[model samples]
Target: MTQEILRAEGLRKSFPGVQALDGVDLTLRPGEVHVLLGENGAGKSTLIKMLSGAHHPDEGRVLLDGQPVDIRDARTAQRLGIATIYQEFNLVPQLTVAENLALGRPPRRFGFVDTRAMRRQAAELLARVGVDVDPATPIAGLGIARMQMVEIAKALALNARILIMDEPTAVLTTGEVDRLFAIVRQLRDAGVAVVFITHHLEEIAEIGDRVTVLRDGRSVAEVAADTPQNELIRLMVGRPIDQQFPRRPAEVGEALLTVRGLSRRGAFDDVSFEVRAGEVVGVAGLVGAGRTEVARAVFGADRYDSGQVSVRGETLARADVHAAMRAGLGLVPEDRKGQGLVLGDDVAANLGLVTLRRATRAGFVDLRAQRRAAAKVAEQLAIRMTGLDQEVRTLSGGNQQKVVIGKWLVAEAGVLILDEPTRGIDVGAKVEIYQLINALTDSGRAVLMISSDLPEILGMSDRILVMARGRLVGELPAAQATQDAVMELAVTDVEASRVQ
Candidate 1:
């Protein structure tokens, strides 16, 4: 029999009011990719947290190579050859690639920092992951793909036997993703056990060997990826879901938001688009196509070197988030934890963030009014929380996203820029968010959505714009949108084609 690299029997975890994991069982075979599937709040995150030592299992046991192991924390997990690469990287931007690669285990000589040796070691590690980057360069200078490669290299350097990758391709281009897959295949051939988690169905067909379904904190079933996509979706979602996006027809009104010749140096250039009230306009592209940058520039969070933005035909200045907000623009950023909310704060405080001025008297927060307003918004969003006073960190990924979105809905915006709004959440919450977006348009709000998810853009948007290398490559009406068409535009060079 093939060796079982890792095994979890009757694993369980519980919080104050939620049983995040109830008797979950997972088996990882050597040299195989085990894909975990679930909706948001299905306890998928909790199970991985226990595996990576971020959380202790309330019951049952974990065994590595047929021997029981106690993983108390992240450090202990790392020491035990279990390495996790989360959707969000844990690299220090200020440090050089070499320093980041050799962090905590840097080579030292005569009590002096050994920069030369560190760079050499970092270069070797990067090469192993198929990344050709200068180790001496600071991490902030690398693109998102290269940064992700650095993360993979860091894990490999620790001699990890079990690798956990969450949404690994969410921010990667086709070329970069192919290279990463090559590395993953290499690891699998070398007898490494990989636990893969993602929402993209095609990825499961491409890389997965065995699949396990989790629903509402319990293991539902396990199957081979060769099983029909519809069947897999049914198992993951716990029901038959036909074509994920269900968009409703909304009458388009006058142009509520407009951008002409929008340019942000080294980011997006000449991004021009218009959105009418009661319309959903989607910006689609491969990773690093400047979709998020365009959203930020239009929302006044980032400066545009040259551009023209108009709200109902009135010109507005760039690089002013507060001005944009006051002018009826709301932005739901891509990185929720970094740009969305204060995770340490309570739900009430987070919900009241944007409208705090109205709930404050002479610079002092009116606690009662803030709490009352937050409760109302929470109730409307259907956020599952014990109460308004609960900490934001305690909520699941879907609820946290709801809290971020609720902040915008509380203060109605004429134009809402939602970047990757349904990312990292489950299918159930995705449906809720879709309904919420529809409700926004029904209320005469224009939505500019940025997403790498092709099906989502095709389903939710009235029209779609595909970007490639900081330029808008092509435009497609929703009725004509297709995945292959978007991929063609996303990979082509727009400037070279114009010359042709």
Candidate 2:
């Protein structure tokens, strides 16, 4: 057997009110992809952070090559041939892609930055990742999917012996994910030990060599990569999810949000759709399919040319977010942290964000009512947090997502536009979000959900709208919307006269 590259023994970590990791043990071997599997709040993040030197464990130790080592910081870990790609990006948006790629260790020529060499090196990295981005483009200019690829490339620059990737495929398209998997396989063949973490269980069998399941801050089991997904789900979530989607079809009602001739030039073109009350209208598409653009146009987050957005028979002004909100339209954006909630504030404040305007009288906000409403919503969502005053930035990914949805719920939105609502969320939290969707539709509200997860689109959506190349190619009812059908439409050209 190959010798172990890294080992963790009885790792324990705690916060003010949370024991993040408790007696978690793990072993990694050279040239192996070790999947750190868990549901949200299952201590997976904490364990990885400890190994990456982002957080020090309260108890237990890490061994590298059978020698006890203190991973004091990220830099120390990197120097010791360990690298990590976190869920949250560690990139500078203002910098060019080439500059970001060569951030810390730029090649110098006689005390000057080697600009040409940097671009050349950046091109090679981008090619390795199968991304065709110009090295000169600013990080801010690229979409979230491209940004994620850049993160992977940046980590690859380290050429570390041990790599830790967290939710690396969350933002990628199906083709991009395949390319990433290929790169990972290459790295594994090159004798690099990879620690992979993802909420998507299918990826475990595809890319992982071994699996470590964490549940409630403890490592519950170590199993083979080819273990049945049902068993893996049971191990991580502690129960079988008989119904992954659990979408209860609601009676279709009148249209709540309508978009006609929505065009955003290069981003999206002539997109039109309507989400009706008491229905979950799912927008399914590949990456860059313009689903998000169309949703944003309807929500007035982005201006649309030659389009009309109407809510409850009232035509909304173009590029007016406040107008959309006043029309009872609430949008859960794709980049939740960047657009949804205020990270620096407390839970109560974030939950009250959408309603603060109405709650204010004579320039004085009603703090009492806000707190009461936040408390109710928090409890309703089962958001795990110590208190309402706790910073939203500190909560787990799943809890933070609930806060975003709670903000809209507190506003009593008649129509909710959810963009990738369960992007990085685990199976349990995903079901919770789906349950919330059912609750919304059951209460005579409308939901326009945009997602890349085809299974989710097929399972939850009452009616599916497929987009490709910035156009709505086809629509399917719940009974007829299979994954194959959606993909067929998703890959269809906009100019096609009829569905293939």
In terms of lDDT, model 2 sits at 0.93
Query: Runs in model 2 with CA error above 4 Å?
Result: 495-500
What's the lDDT of the predicted structure labeled candidate 1? 0.87
In candidate 2, what are the lDDT values of residues 1-500, reduced to their tens digit?
Answer: 99999999999999988899889999999999999999889998889888888999899999999999999899889989999998988899999999999998998999999999999999999999999999999999988899999999999999999999999999887889999999999999999999999999889999999999999999999999999999999998899989888999888889998888888889887777888999999998888888888888888888887889999999999999999999999999989898888999999999999999999999999999999999999999999999999999888899999999999999999999999999889999999999999999999999999998888898899999989988888899999888888888888877665454
State the lDDT of candidate 1 residue by residue for 1-500, as single tens digits: 78898999999899988899999999999899999988777888888889999999989999998999988999999988899988778899999999999999999999988989999999899988778889989999886667888898898888789999987776666677788888889899999999999877778878999999998899999999777888987887777876578788688999988899998788988888899999999998877788887888888888899989888887887788887888788999877988899999999989988888766788898888777778888998999888887899888788999999998877767888999998787677888899888888998988999887788889999999999999998999999889899888888887788799
Candidates in order, TM-scores: namely 0.94, 0.98
Model 2, residue 184: displacement in angstroms? 0.8
Clashes of each: 1, 0
Which residue runs does candidate 1 get wrong by more than 4 Å? 109-111, 130-132, 142-145, 364-366, 498-500
Q: Which ten residues in a row have the lowest lDDT in candidate 1?
A: 167-176
After the best TM-score superposition of candidate 1, give how far the Cα of residue 305 lies from its true spot, in angstroms. Answer: 1.9
